[model samples]
Target: MIKVGIVGGTGYTGVELLRLLALHPHAKVCAVTSRKEAGMRVDAMYPSLRGYTDVVFSTPEDAGLGECDVVFFATPNGIAMGEARALLDAGVRVIDLAADFRIGNVAEWEAWYGMRHASPELVAEAVYGLPEVNREAICGARLVANPGCYPTAVQLGFLPLIQSDAIALDSLIADCKSGVSGAGRKAEVSSLLAEAGDSFKAYGVAGHRHLPEIRQGLSRVAGEPVGLTFVPHLTPMIRGIHATLYARLVRDVDLQDVFESRYANERFVDVLPAGSHPETRSVRGGNLCRIAVHRPQGGDTVVVLSVIDNLVKGAAGQAVQNMNLMFGFAEDAGLGIVPLQP
Candidate 1:
């Protein structure tokens, strides 16, 4: 079994890792670290994991992470970089589910995240963990940088268009809406139920942090710098991200066929039938991205709708998918969960 260690066991993503790994046939949770919640049974804090895990939260120093085969950092951005080097030197594979090493340029990451990168050299060595794009790289990577929630949905929506060179590169737009859980499990005035509930408004219109990461991924596919306008919104729900992407078609082609062929082999990306509208709830609690492509009145514009559970495909589930690839397990191992419905 692949022994696993998790850093920061209290947040949404942290418990999410615990919940998913509990079902993994070839993986085991060895340690879970939390400075504040040390000595507390993990199941006590999150009852959803009661019968699944018997591990208790411990301090990082006492976690014995060096002995684990792989360690997942589900903590805040700065925390992972400060400690990843030592773990890597111990020959343990590391997967960071934060923005620590997602961006290729350290200076750019610093400007947006508002902190000096602790391990800039490791940034280059870390593979971006978007399995659809970097599957081969992730397999051999000692350090994996998991993509953010918004980037995951947006990139998947625009990937086929960019790769086929079928869209006007300079005018790409991603209008996204995410549930409140995207804000993380924090006690902030903005995230309070009274504040975020019964409200649907757009934030980060000027420049969201995920903008550059999305641009970087698309630019790499298009082989050139693409102009993109990415705006994110907060919805009243608890999970999922719905990304409505727009790009002008540079040539005439079947939009449905393009998407279907592009994702036919990808088990997690579902291409809905033509003229179908995919709902966020359809992918809730599952590591799946449901997409639908359209052409308005046969115009030059093409629209693609993509939906994913922010905490699942957008975070923990995708991390597990990467671990599966790194360890040569089935890509869907432990992630074969049906979406939760009303």
Candidate 2:
């Protein structure tokens, strides 16, 4: 079995990781770290994991992560950077489900994240773990940086157009809305039911952190700088992200065909049939990114609608997917979760 250690097993993503790995045929959770909750049974805290995992929460110092075949950092940004180098040097592959090594430029990363990058050298070695764009790189990477939730949906929605030069790169808009769980397992008042429930408002119009991450990915595909206006909103729901992407058509091509062909071989990205509008509920609790492309009035504007469960495809499930690729297992191992419906 592929022994796995998870740092920070207290968040929504961390528990989701445990839930998915429980069904993995080739992997097992060896350690799950939480300094404050050390010695507490993981199942005691997250009752959903009652029978699958009997592993108790261990302090970070006692996790013995270096002995594991791979370690996943489900902690917040910056936590992975501090321990990744040591784990890698010890021959334990690392996958960070945080933004620590996602951005290539160290200065830009520090500026946006408001913290010093602990290991710039490791950042150079870490691959951006977007299987669609960097599958080859992820296979041999000692450290993999999982893409952010908003960035994942936005880039997937815009990729086909940018790669084919079918749309204008000068003006791209991603009007995305994410459920409150995307905010993470925090106790802040803003995340409370009274504040986030029955309420909807855009929070990061001024310039969200995921803006640069998405721009970098799309610009790389377009072979030039892209002018993108990304605005993210907080929806009342508890999961999923719905991104309505707009781009001006610079050339005429079949948008539906383009998307379908681009993701034909991708297991997680579901390019819906022509004239279909994908809904967030269609992808909730699943490791799928369901997208639909549209052109209004057969005009010059091309619109793409993309939906994904913020915690699954956008976080832990994607991390596990990376692990499978890194270890030469089936790409969809432990990630065949069907979307939960009403």
Candidate 3:
């Protein structure tokens, strides 16, 4: 079994990893680190995970991550860079669920994130882990930088069109709404129940950090610079992301067939029936990403709507998928948990 260690295990993504790894057949969670809540039993902190993971949270200094085959950093943006090099040098692979190594350019990363990268030299070695697009690279990668939730939905919804030159690259706009949990497990005043419940508002319109990350991925597919306007909103729910991508159709082609043909064989991505609107609830707690296509009234405008469980497909589940690829196991191994449909 592949031993796994999770740094920052007190957060939403970290606990989600433990929840999923508990049932994973080929993996074992060995260590979980938390600087603030060290020495407390993980299950005592998260009663939902009781009996599944008995390991307690320890301080960062006490985490001997080299004991595990892979380590997942579910901490905030800048935390992973400080420890990634040391861990990888010790032959322990890393999968960062933060934004530390997602952007290819160090300057652009530093510009939006407001801090210089901690280990820029190792930036050359980290692979952007989007299983559908960069599967081959993730297989042998020692360090994998998992994509953000918004980027995951937007890119999957538009990648095929961009790759086929069916959509204009210069005029791309992605409007996405994510559950309150996407803000993280932190106690932010803005994410409180009163602030988020029954109220919806967009934040970081012009300069969201995920903007560069999305552009880098879409640009790679379009083979050109993809300038995009990405706006994200906070939803009332606890999980899931719904993204509506707008692009000008470069050619007069059936948008339905375009999406259908592209995702025909994809295991995790599904193109819903024509005229069908996908609900975020339909994919909650699962690794599935359900997307739909629409040719709006405007002749050149196409709207692509996609939904996914922000914590699952967007984070923990994707990390497990990467682990499976790295270990030569089934891509969907231990990740086939069906969506929780009520």
Candidate 4:
């Protein structure tokens, strides 16, 4: 079995990594690091992991993670850069679930995240870990930077159109909404039940961090610099992201052509029927991304709607899918998780 370790094991994404990896047929959870709850048993802290893992949380320095084949950093944006150099030097592959290495430009990274990148030199080497687009690069990569939840939904929704040169690069707009859990397990006053519940307000409209990351992904496909207005909102639910994308079609293309031409054989992504609307609850707790296409009445704009469980397709489960690709295991090894329906 491939031995694995997780740094920052108490957060939502960290525990989520534990949830998915525990059932992975080819992986063993060797270490999980947490400074606050260092001596506590992993399962004891999260009873959901009761029978699956009995390991204890320890500090990253004392976790003996170098012995493991893979390490996942589910910490804040800047935490991974500090530990990545040492872990990689010891032949341990790293997957960061933070925004540390997503943006290729260092200045842009600092400008959005508000902190100097701890290891800017390594930025060039860390591959963007969206398997659907960068699968080949991830095969032999030592470090993979998982895309953000909003970016993931937006990128996947618009990639095919951009790649086919069907849309103008400059006129892209992504209006996305994510559940409260996307904010992470932190105790911010803004994230409290009272503040978020019964509220459907958009934050980070003028300049959200996911804007650059989304542009980076689309630019790669467009073969030109792409600019977009990304507006993100918080929903009252616990999980999922539904991103509605609008881009002017460069040439006249019917909605059906866009659907059949792009996602015909995609397993996890389903292009919906002509008039169907994709919903978040339909894809909860699963690695599925449901998409739909529509042409605005008497307009040249082609509308695309995409939905995914933010914590699954957007975070931890996607991380496991990358691990399977890196280790030569089946792509859906532990992630054969179907959506949990009502």
Off by over 4 Å in 4: none
- Distance from true location, Cα of 202 in model 3, Å: 1.0
- Each prediction's TM-score against the native? 0.99, 0.99, 0.98, 0.97
Query: For model 3, what is the alpha-carbon lDDT of residue 23?
Result: 90
Name the better of 1 and 3 by lDDT. Answer: 1
Candidates in order have lDDT scores of 0.95, 0.93, 0.91, 0.90
Error of 3 at 5 (Å): 0.0
| Candidate 2 lowest-lDDT run of ten | 333-342
TM-score of 1: 0.99
Residue-by-residue lDDT tens digits, candidate 1, 200-223: 999999999999999999999889
Show where candidate 2 strays beyond 4 Å. Answer: none
lDDT of 4 at 128: 97
lDDT (10s digit) by residue, model 2, range 279-321: 9999988999999999999999999999999899899989999
C-alpha lDDT of candidate 2 relative to the true structure: 0.93
- How far in Å is the alpha carbon of 62 misplaced in model 1? 0.4
Best candidate according to lDDT: 1
State which candidate, 2 or 3, has the greater lDDT.
2
As a whole number from 0 to 100, the lDDT of residue 337 in candidate 3 is 95
Ranking by lDDT: 1, 2, 3, 4
